[model samples]
Target: MKKLLLGSVCGLGLAAGPALAADLGVPVRAAPVAVVVPGFSWTGFYVGANAGYGGGKFDYPFNAFQRQLQAEAPAIESRLDGRLGLTSGGFILGGQLGYLYQFDNRLVAGVEADFQWSGIEGRLSGTGTLTGTGTLPGTFSLDAGSQVRWFGTLRARLGYAWDRALLYATGGLAYGQVRSHADISAANGGTPIPGLTGGVATSHTRWGWTVGAGLEYALTQNWSFKTEYLYVDLGTSNVLSSAVDDPGNGFSAGASMKVTTRFHTVRAGINYRF
Candidate 1:
């Protein structure tokens, strides 16, 4: 009787152990996982568009014309002594393409090229009478104007970037198309002098240099916005206007004018990186 009782108890213990193991379920080893982190980088190619205001100075010096007139027609020297310096401002729209690289030390460098369409213009005029003894008694009128049609720049950029923002200084070559016009006419006794009317219209593409600074903010990993200011000088262009005497008359004179263009531009832009 004692052996049978012990055998039954062992059997019961074995059966309970298997049931408990089944209820607890089998052990599983989890697979390894990879963790990823995102970081910002300023190494890429970008294209962008900009819109803003541009204003500047158009300096017209009549010194050469005045000197020539002084020797040829002394009566008009006083009128020709006046110079024209006009300030012009207008809307500007443009696009840019560039590439940038960021160094480990937080230095960012890049090169960019941009083109802009502009509508900056200004006009100036004056009227006077030439009444000296040797002069043709008439009222002289002078009208002059200048316009900046378009402009462009190729620049190198250097900056310090802090995470998602960059502050930079830029300088490079600048070029632009400029148009200028001058009209000078004379009226004697309320009648216009046919042979004395002179006009000059000149269009030129001028080259010079530009310098600027800007701040750019990265809105996302692939997009950025920037605000910038640039000062540009497109150098000078020469224009000539001449008045001829009638066929038999020997008196003929020409005026040489120098038009210098310089401007300031403030702009906002959006860029996409690739």
Candidate 2:
């Protein structure tokens, strides 16, 4: 009886030992994943292409005689107010590369240069009455036709950044190139007679300043999107009158155009943070 009891105890011990070993063989649990926070180390270089609409207002200050004649001229008689209004809507493309310095409180300051190939233009017409011993009073009408101007800006930015989004304002130097044209005519008994048709093309690069604000949001670790508005004053340029000599006028008028352009752009771009 003692031998039989010993064998049964040995069998129970073997079975219990296998069960304990199986529990010990289980794999260890994995640690939780680490969250990646965007850092202020976006101090690398980047390039991007953007297309958006651009528009601006322009003023052409007239001479004393021109202003007086314009005021007295009938609205239907023909005249282009020396002002070019709200003319905007063009495609803009450019690239940017800059260095960003981040402070302890997440404020970022940087310098950037941006350029654009633009197509923005406007047209205006004006008529002045010609007085002489004619049987009926006649009118001399001068019409400024469609003129195209292309411009670009280079700026520096300062802003506060929140992880994947940045709200900032920028101001810096601006530059551009433009072309102008005009058409002149005379009216007899309301019958239009075309006079001098001439134009001038000028390649101008001016040193000006710009101020704008923008919001840039990150779409991915390597890509960002932005919307911005910039106000620019490209200083002034002289645009000579086209029909100065058609009627042998001894003194031809020269118009000084003071150009101020404001651009609002919405763009999507990709940047590789280094």
Which number leads on lDDT? 1
Alpha carbon RMSD to native, model 2? 8.3
Give the per-residue lDDT digits (tens) of candidate 2, residues 29-139.
689999996564444555565666666655554331121122354322223334544354555666666666767787878887777776666666766764433243456
lDDT for model 2, please: 0.58
Candidate 1 weakest lDDT stretch, 10 residues? 63-72
Q: Give candidate 2's error at residue 256 in angstroms.
A: 6.8
Cα lDDT of model 1 by residue, 97-151, tens digit = 9999999998999999999999888888987774544444667787889999999
Please report the TM-score between candidate 1 and the true structure. 0.76
Runs with alpha carbons beyond 4 Å of true place in candidate 1: 1-38, 63-79, 129-138, 186-196, 243-252
Ten-residue region with minimum lDDT total, candidate 2? 62-71
* RMSD (CA, Å), each prediction: 6.0, 8.3
lDDT of 2 at 146: 28
